[model samples]
Target: MDREFRYTQKDFNRARAFLLQLTGIKLADSKDSLVYSRLVPRLRKLQLEDVRRYVDYLEQHPEEEEHFINALTTNLTSFFREPHHFDILSEFIQRGEVVNRVWCAASSTGEEPYSIAMTLVNVAGGFASSAQVIASDIDSNVLRHASDGIYPLEKVNPLNNKKLFFKRGVGVNAGKARVCAQLRKLLEFQKINLLDEEYPVKAGLDVIFCRNVMIYFDKDTQEKILLKLLSKLRTGGLYIAGHSENFSHFSHLMKPIGRTAYIKL
Candidate 1:
């Protein structure tokens, strides 16, 4: 088996089809280089000679599915990446609403959910104690990192309440920060593929943060995922989306309340 595997169009198509089937993420033809870069490492690790062999291995070994998904999925995220949504959340909390359960649907590397947790802790007033957030993503590797709750110091330095939600490392551990125990207690990290017919989360969610993820899917897949997410959202509950997303198709079910934020009517 050669380590320098040449990924052909056929190889790219096969891998793309399998990924789309499993995760509903339609890889564009232009992603040929990106696919090659991500999957070649997998080929080497699995002792396979080429992309075709790797695809065959994927079909034969269902258990390798998680590794395959972990390899291809993108997990770009940051704390409070969209600050406006958090502002809306703060206002929602202040309104004395019944917001007990929150869901960070694409909780890549834990930033979005942690930001949600910080908002609840800081702005939810007394209601923060009873609230819980479920943070999930398709990538098992990123889920592990999210659970660890450690980030570089610079990531949290901009946050106003950095000292409250994160513990700044000292002595030998300087220049690093870890999520404090109080904030970590409010979040649960799990592996969830939105392509699934149904999620394991409890219904009546108060807030759903399905951010910066749907942009990877086509229209049909996006609509299906939105419908499922809406079913889990309780009446008057909020749904936060990435700034670039447009849920105009589901306007009958939800009304826009703010920039990329919606409320179930």
Candidate 2:
């Protein structure tokens, strides 16, 4: 097949290996096309001739790592992507488990964390409660998008009770909506790379919403990150995982509550 710039298997391997070293994420051989697509823009920006040159440039300029990660990281999510998780969170709060603070480990463009904030507000029967959502992602680009709190209208409209949490856009901003002030105020976005030895979050969080992101990591890396995440949760605090990810093998550390939701032991 013809392409815009020279790309080869070795180039893909080196790029993916560097990605794994920086982010603890694994890309399969099937991801070759994806690697090509993501890196092509970088090649153009740097006036490079091929993927190999981009890889070498990355090696020499450590600061380029941020743009490299931002370009490749996927942030496909929506409000209440897995609706059941929010129900579980509501239940966790209702049971008086002290859900005054929560963490969204992969907040991706804001939907999940905003959903979290909405749930907390609804559970409290209003916005009067003192609760906060610590939203984080390794991808700085998505973090900025999340912080801006603007999204297409179609994405916001399908959500139940959206009027309570979102403001429809107008004029030049039509066909989009912004998360309401109440919901936006409850969140604090941060850039956090899961591969780091120590996270900056406080210990004893009330709930952690670290969903599908773990699927990108190998088993050992998954386990290592899970333990570090659990250490942040208070005993009996809620831990929610994506439907595609399961932690039943680690039952000794968590009690299965509902679906992929767990109560940290």
Give the number of the best model, judged by lDDT: 2
**Tens-digit per-residue lDDT, 1-265, candidate 1:** 2337866789889999999999998998889888888988788888888788898899999998998999999988999998999999989878878778999998989999999988888785533477899999999889998999989988989888787788888988799899998889999988899999989988899999999999989989999999999899999999999999978668999999999899998
Report lDDT (CA) for all predictions. 0.89, 0.92
Best by TM-score: 2
Give TM per candidate: 0.95, 0.98
Candidate RMSDs in order: 2.1, 0.8
Cα TM-score of candidate 2: 0.98
User: Model 1 segments beyond 4 Å from truth?
Assistant: 1-3, 125-128, 170-173
